[model samples]
Target: MRDSAAGVLLGLACGDALGRPVEFQQTASIQRRHGRVTEMLANGAHGQPAGTITDDTKMALCIAQSLVESGSFDPDDVAGRFVEWYQSGPFDIGILTSTILRRLRNGDAWDEAGIDEWKHLPEGSNAGNGSVMRCAPYGIAFAGEPDALVTASRVSSAITHADPRCQWGCVILNATLAGLLAGEKQPLTSALELAADAPAELRTACEAVLSIMEGSESATDLELANSGYVVTTLQAGLYHGLTAESVEDAIVEAVMLGGDTDTIAAVAGAVAGARFGASELPDRWLRAIDETAEIRELGQQLDTMEISFPESIVEKLSSGQFDLQA
Candidate 1:
């Protein structure tokens, strides 16, 4: 239970790296080539090392570090860190995230950066799983305060993603993970009910998640969409995570769904991690993630964060007075 933070973070990285090699392959190909992909293997999508994680874990690490440093949701700091990471050249990055960050680099303010970008992109491409994939750190840091969790999740998402589904995607995920960390017996349900203020689209996707968990809708029947679309990814990821019997099986099943495999598995891994503590996560999977030690350390730091929210930051966030230089 106490290891929920480390479990969620490390679980995400493990899932990302495990699925890295076979990201775009169909379920049949995955089953035929490697039934139950349990170990980290090299030469898949990006042709990196066996334990190499993609941008999902890397961006999460950035968010975790910013939260620890600021002791709150510092949107500016988070934005700057993302810009820095983008400049450093990550191997894998979502299209929306890259577009928004590039605009940020070109002098768009943190608060204003994503608005225009989101406006130009059409529906299917606008709401991507980018924000949701890296938002677990906010859940860990704000595990005690649901209101603050929602605010942080939504605001930080504007650093790159501004769509309601994208923004509420983070809200739903972080809220659920926060509840799990707080030891809610029915964490996901608690989160959904608590997030009643979230957009209806988010609720619809979340209802799909429950349907999967209730065993009434088969994964195949539920139309497990593994695309980068936020709603589909959320549905499929949570379906696999909440429905599977074990952590390994959950991650494997999500990745086996094919497209957007790493991100889907990352999201599923976080949900499964909350359900089963860090102790339940396989040592082999942990060892396989190259940043395992960093993930554990960062998760611990976030878990123990003594929240000291000042009125000034809240005012700035609420009034839309975010400082890009902060």
Candidate 2:
């Protein structure tokens, strides 16, 4: 469990840093320029050094730090840490995330900020991958605690992405991660089974991954639709993360999908890392990212920490506000 937990964080950082250089490039463009992005190259989308992480890993680190410090799912303290990160003026925050964080900085309550911003956006544009990308920590922290993991996943996402799809997206991803951490034989399927109330779009995404794994669905990169939408990211990330033969292969395949490279790969990396364990991650990739050590330490701390959900969150879970399959 400890090794797999550490793998989740290290793999997330590896994907973020590796894909940072070619983030939005089309598959053709990335192939033309770099052949295959196996190494962390500098000066691409963000113009930073090699192995530099973007908002995906950065925001996740904030959540990890908050979890380790509070030893629980304290949304208030997590919000404060996010505000601190936003104040740092990161170069690659998502549009919805930036607006919500701006609201947070201006004294809007953490829970209210995302809900208000989500209210004004149209359906198609409302849900982004921002929340899901930073949610893997909860998977490790609450590996055997399904109810607390589900509540934490949804609430954490609601702080920045209030759409049901966005909220459930985090639930499905972390639930799957928790399954992997516990050494389940079919982690993705287990996650889907637990998400009895998940949106059809999210359900279909998980089903598609199952099909691909079973040799009944297409697994091509074009079919992955490397977009920033929550459903698309979830599908692509799970396909690669759960299907790849190796940790390095999962991340590389995700980057090869092109659009939203860092985020898709980060999600895939976390899942793949859980499956393969941190020792299976490439040493070269591990040494490149600056946050590798800290992420590893946080993962260890999370695995060893005793979980205690806050009273309010526990009541909400008990009230069936966010029901999951028993």
What overall lDDT, based on C-alpha atoms, would model 2 receive against the true structure? 0.89
Once fitted onto the true fold, the runs of candidate 2 whose alpha carbons sit more than 4 angstroms away are: 218-222, 316-326
In model 1, which range of ten residues has the least summed lDDT? 317-326
lDDT of 2 by residue, 217-325 (tens): 6766227788899999999899889989999999999999999999999999999999999999989888888778888999999999886788887776578754322
127-226: candidate 1 lDDT, tens digit per residue: 8889999999989888888778877888787678888787788888887888878777656787788778667877887887776666666556677777
Measured on C-alpha atoms, candidate 1 has an lDDT of: 0.83
- On TM-score, the leading prediction is 2
Residue 279 Cα positional deviation in candidate 1, in Å, after optimal superposition: 1.8
- Per-model TM-score versus the true fold: 0.93, 0.95
